[model samples]
Target: MKKIAVVAANGRVANKVITEAVSRGFDVTGFGRKENNTKAQHYVQKDLFDLTSEDLKGFDAVVDAFGAWTEETLPQHSTSLKHLCDILSGTDTRLLIVGGAGSLYVNKEHTATVMEGPDFPDAFKPLASAMGKALGELRERKDVKWTYISPAGDFQADGERTGKYLLGGEELTLNDRGESVISYADYAIAMVDEIEKGNHIQQRISVVRA
Candidate 1:
């Protein structure tokens, strides 16, 4: 059984990912600030602010599902992502991260630019932009096997897992409806599947409902 470690397991996507991983017979471990109420038997309660490389040993893969929306939290998020990269550097373990859609491309001439438009939230622009930069940096690194998965633009709270999705590389992918959307459950499934198969390494990909 492959051992998978998920950071920020309390979030909606992480929770579903953990559940799907567990169901698939993977030995799942969760690292987060608070104890997750899910059925994951191995839960490590630790603040990401205090986490070190030493705390992340013996895992085949690490899924970073951490997210933040405030300027104060951007530094922590960036630091944690770098720390995870550092820990997995030179190791065979993979880092699967939940990335933002704002950085994705909408067309050949325009990118799904965030923080530059009027509708972009002033408070969240910094955080989103920071995440985009962090992901870009991770792509340049050669030591760790990292894959960033960005959800579609229509991501929301409740959606059913149809076990159907479209996958694409750095270029943003959309469904037949001309919108990008995937349920938390299906997103979790895709993350685990990528981890197990080591697909799309060192690249950022997007998933949307088909």
Candidate 2:
């Protein structure tokens, strides 16, 4: 991709994504509500909901890193993506999402998701549920060329960047050590790689340390 737009670029994951994408010489623009939170080739102080396809017409891809921190705002996951789908539907611009691992299946049967596992923390259920619903809603749309990538069970914000990762389908992925983890830094590499390669279109994929 020659150009990309990152929503909520000030986020922990998104900031790293911006750095990685820029390092690869892609024209990157960031859109967020907060001004001066992060650096991008171009920064626009716009709400994610305010963005239009017209606003991102020329971008090869747009990354949705929008986060909803509170239980009350959990539905933003679905609504924001729906709004984006509405605008970008039928367009050549691809929509790439930074999703959670909660929805990932725990087995090859694909009947159970990680969020439903007993060891999952009850406190985080609402957020996970919201994200899972968003993914479900996204799946129903055939017009949007969207790719959603869920992180590993342990999505480490300050974890070390190994520059290596393993890719998986619907099931949760584990490394050789049987650990499910990935750093924001390395995940950014996978994200940018997907952007450039245009693989996994209209699919949900997982990435963890190889």
Residue lDDT tens for model 2, 1-210: 389999988899999999999999999999999984665789998999999878889999999999996977999999999999999999999999999999999888899999999999998899999999999999999999999999999999999989999998889999999999999999999999999998888999999999
List, residue by residue over 39-107, the lDDT tens digit for candidate 1: 676998987656666667778888998888766777666777888888778888888999887677656
Q: Worst lDDT window (10 residues) for model 1?
A: 110-119
Q: After aligning candidate 1 to the native by TM-score, how far in Å is the CA of 13 from where it should be?
A: 1.2
Error of 1 at 146 (Å): 0.6
The candidate that wins on lDDT is 2
Q: How does each model score on TM-score?
A: 0.90, 0.98
Model 2 stretches astray by more than 4 angstroms: none
Q: Lowest-scoring 10 consecutive residues by lDDT in candidate 2?
A: 32-41
TM-score of 2: 0.98
For each predicted model, how many residue pairs clash, with residues at least 3 apart or on different chains? Answer: 0, 0
